[model samples]
Each structure stands twice: as structure tokens, then as C-alpha cells.
Target: MIVGIDISKKWFDAAWQVDGQGRHQRFEYTDEDIGQLLAQTPEAAHYVMEATGTYHARLALRLHESGRRVSVVNPLVIKRFSQMQLSRVKSDRADAELIRRYGEQQPLSPWAPATDEVLELQQAHGWLNDLIGERTRLLNRREAHAHHAKPNAFVISQMAAQLQQLDGQIKTCERHLEVMVKKSFTELFERLLTIPSIGAKTAIELIIVTDGFRRFEDVKALCAYIGVSPTTFRSGSSVNGKGGIAKLGQGRMRQLLYLCSWTAKTCNPACRALYARLKALGKPPKVINVAIAHKLLRQAFAVATTNAPFSTEYA
Candidate 1:
């Protein structure tokens, strides 16, 4: 038995199949509702739900605590499954049914909650990103005000104060994140830092995202998960296009890797050689950077699995 749940901010819809027929129910986001739903389903039934940001966390955690089997899948996977089934209905009820059928048909691994340290690092990283975003907005506002013909001194001073404050907050958050990583993943953090162009922040971000590298077993899967793996688009000679990243995974991580690639191409021996060879072949700058980012991920994975620091001599 499998129950598919479509969760929202306030409620969720659950669907399952019984006697070759469909059964569906809606419930509020509460302990009582969750208990009732569990009672209604078979003890052996598997519950599957999409990872809907933080909205699904409460229910998923509750389910796991109650000893029910829970599988939290990526939303992209469910979207692809829906497309394959030619699903046209776009309601919560339909989504729940689709999720149920997906669980029943596809092989899925159970989701594991992140450890306390990793979770705390993730929260801190998210806060840092938010602060960075705010800083950017403040910068743009300052620039706009500067060109305001009159350029009010009062507004400019306020913006400057705000920017300084945000910078301090961002630095504090980053420092806290590094401390958390060092406390829980000291060896991994140090190892990752040995890779050229991979600084403390990048290493911390990778650990937080990969849950200390327990989420993936190999470099290939990690590359794909980080959205740095190459994707081809060619059906026949008549229909062909340039290959690029799939861009179906973590966008923020992908962006961060891309930024790191700029430095990696110059300092990292392996990446430098690859960049030179690709540049010789006339590959575009963006294409070359993506490749370097991919290479960085490969190095990160290798060091993580081998429990060793990266060495330029190995290049």
C-alpha cells in the first residue's frame, strides 16, 4: 500500500488505491489530522510526498517519528512523472493521486533527516544568502539614489548605514557557519579547503547541501545533483542543438560553483590545464567555466570519498 500526499501551507491531500479503486482524503496540518490519517491507512502502507520546501517538513517528520515509512521525493521528479503520464489535471486532489501512483510504481529510497550540525549550518547558510541578497538590493537603491538629480544626503546616509549593518550580519553568519562545520565535519572541511578556489564558505555550503556527502556515493551523481553535468539535445541530424547543463537541480549551488570556476580556471592545476585545452579548441568562455565547475565538483567528490586532501602533484 502507498499513500501520496500533496502538502500546502495549511493542509494536505492524500490519495491511495484500494481494491483497484482510488481513495482520497484531505486533512489539516495538525497532529489530530495526521493521527486520523494514519489510523485510516494500513500500518504497512508507504507514505510518499514531494519536498515542498518547509511546508512538508512538519508532516514528514511526524510521520517518520510515528514509525511510518516515508519517502520524500524531489518536486522535479514528480513533475517529470506527471508529464510522462500526460496528466492534465492540476488540482491538489489530482496531485495527491499522482504522487500515490508514483510511489506504487517507482522504486524510491527513504528520506533521512539531516543531523543537528548539518541542519544548523544549512539554516545559517540560508541566512547568509538572504543577507547577501538584501545587500545587493541596498546597493542598487544607493546607486539609484545617487542618480536622483538632487541625491538626498539623508537617504544616502541611511542606505550606507544599512549596507554596513548587512555586511556585518553576513560576516557573522558566515563565521558561525564555519564554526558549525568545523565542529561536526572538521576533517571534511579541511580536506575540501585544500582544493584550489574552494574556500571555507564553499566547503561549508557543499557539506550542508550534501548532508556531509552522505546524499551521494559518486562524483557523477553529485555533479548531476548540483546541476553541473552536461546535457545533450540531439534527436537526429535534422534536429540538433548545443549541449548545456540540465539546470534541473540546485540553482544556488550551481551558481556558486560557476562563480568558483572563474578562480579555479587560473589557480587549480587540473582545471587550468582543462581550461587551456578547451580554450584552444575554441570553446566559449561560459562553456569553459561550466566545465571547470564540473571538474571542481569531481574533485570535491574524490576528496570526500577518499578522505584525503587534494594535491596538485596528483594532477
Candidate 2:
């Protein structure tokens, strides 16, 4: 038996298949509703749902804890799968059916919830990012005021105070995050820090994004998840074009990797060589930078996996 669920903030639609027969239903976003739905499902039935942020987390966790097989798939993958169908109708029930069909047709890995420490790290990273963005906005506003002929002293003073507060908060968040990483993922964090151009901030961010290196199976999977892997674009002879990175994963992680790649290309011997070769071949800077980012991630993965510090000689 296979079950597919389309999750939303308030409710979820469900579709089930058994003995080549199909059924569809809807339920409220409550424990009672979930219990009622599960009553009809076999204990061994496989449940599939999309990763709809926090909306799906509680239900998925509950289902998993109840000894059900659960697969939380990426929304993009489900969307692409839906596009294959001939029917143009779109609704919650339809989506549930699509997800059910998708689960039936595709081989999907079961989902695993992150550990408490990893979840805490993810939240801390989000707070740090928010503080950084606030600081940037304040700085930009201050800069604009400085350029004005008749700047408002009061506004400028307020902006300065806000910036100072944000800076302090940012520092505190970083310190707390460092302590968490050291306590929960000490060896992995240390190994990542040993990589060229990977500082404490970048290493911590990588750890959080990779769920302390527990999410992906290999360097290639890591690259694809971070949107650093190149994606080919080709059809018949009439639609041939240059391929590029998919940019389908976490955008912030890709941006951070790009920034790190700039430093890696200059400081890391292996990355520098690759950068120079690509430049000599007249590859664009964007393409070269992405390649360097991919290389850096691969190195990070290797050192972390081996529980060893990064070594340039091996590179």
C-alpha cells in the first residue's frame, strides 16, 4: 500500500492505493484528524509528502514516530512530475493523486528528521542571517544620509544606534553558534575549518546547511543540493545550448559558496590551478567561479568524511 499527502498550512489532502485500487480524502491539520486517517492505513503502508516547510514537519514527524515509512520529497521534484500528466486540472485532491502516482513510480529515500542540535543550529543560522541583513540595510541607509547635502542628524544618530545594536546581536549569535558547533559537531567543524578559504562563519553555515554532514551521501549530492553542480541543457539539434548551474537548491548557500570560491581561487593551490586553466580556456568568470565552488565543496566533503584536516598535497 502507498499513501500520498498534499500538505498545507491548515489541512492536508490524502490519496491512497491498495491492490491496484485508489481512494482520495481530506483531513484537518490536527492530531485527531491524523489519527482517524491513519486508522484506515496499513501499518506498513508507505506515506509520501512534499517538503512544505514547517507546515509538514509535525505531521511527518508524527507519522514517522508511529512506525510508518515516510518520504518527504522536494516540491520541485513533485512539480516536475505533475507536469508529465495530460490532465490540466489543479487542486489539492489532484495534487494528492499526483504525489501518490509519483510515490508509486519513483524510488525515494525515506526522510529522517534532524537531531535537536542540528535543528537548533539551523534556527541560529537563520537568526544570524536576519541580523546581517538588518545591519546591511542600516549601513546602506547611513551611507545614503552621508551623501545628502542636508542630512538629518537625528535620523543618522538613530541609524547608528540601530547598527550598533545589530552588530552586538550578530556577535552574540555567532558566539552561541560557535559553541553549539563545537559541542555537537566538534570534529566536523574543525575539519571544515581546515579547508582553504573556509573560515568559521562559512564552516558553520556549511554544517548547518548540510545538517552536520548527515543529509547527503557524497560530494556530488552535496553539490547538487547547494545548487553548485552544473546542469546540462540539450534537446534535439534545434535546441542545443550551453548548460549552467540549476540554481534549484538553497540560494543563500550558493551565494556563500560563490564568495568563498573567490578566495579559494586565489589562495588554494588546487583551486587556483583550476581557475587559471579555465581562464586560459576563455571560460566566463561566473562559470569559473561556480567550478571553483564545486571544487571547494568536494574538498570540504573529503576532509570531513575522512575526519582529517585538509591537505594541499593531496589536492
Best by lDDT: 1
Q: What is the lDDT for 232 in model 1?
A: 84
Per-residue C-alpha lDDT of model 2 across residues 234-264, encoded as one tens digit per residue? 8988888889987878787788788999999
**Among these predicted structures, which one has the highest TM-score?**
1
User: In model 2, which residue pairs have backbone atoms overlapping below 3 Å?
Assistant: none
Task: Say what the RMSD of model 1 is.
Answer: 1.8
- Model 2 scores worst on lDDT over the 10 consecutive residues at 80-89
TM-score against truth, every candidate: 0.93, 0.89
Using alpha carbons, what is the TM-score of model 1?
0.93
Backbone atom clashes (below 3 Å) for every candidate: 0, 0
Query: TM-score of the candidate numbered 2?
Result: 0.89
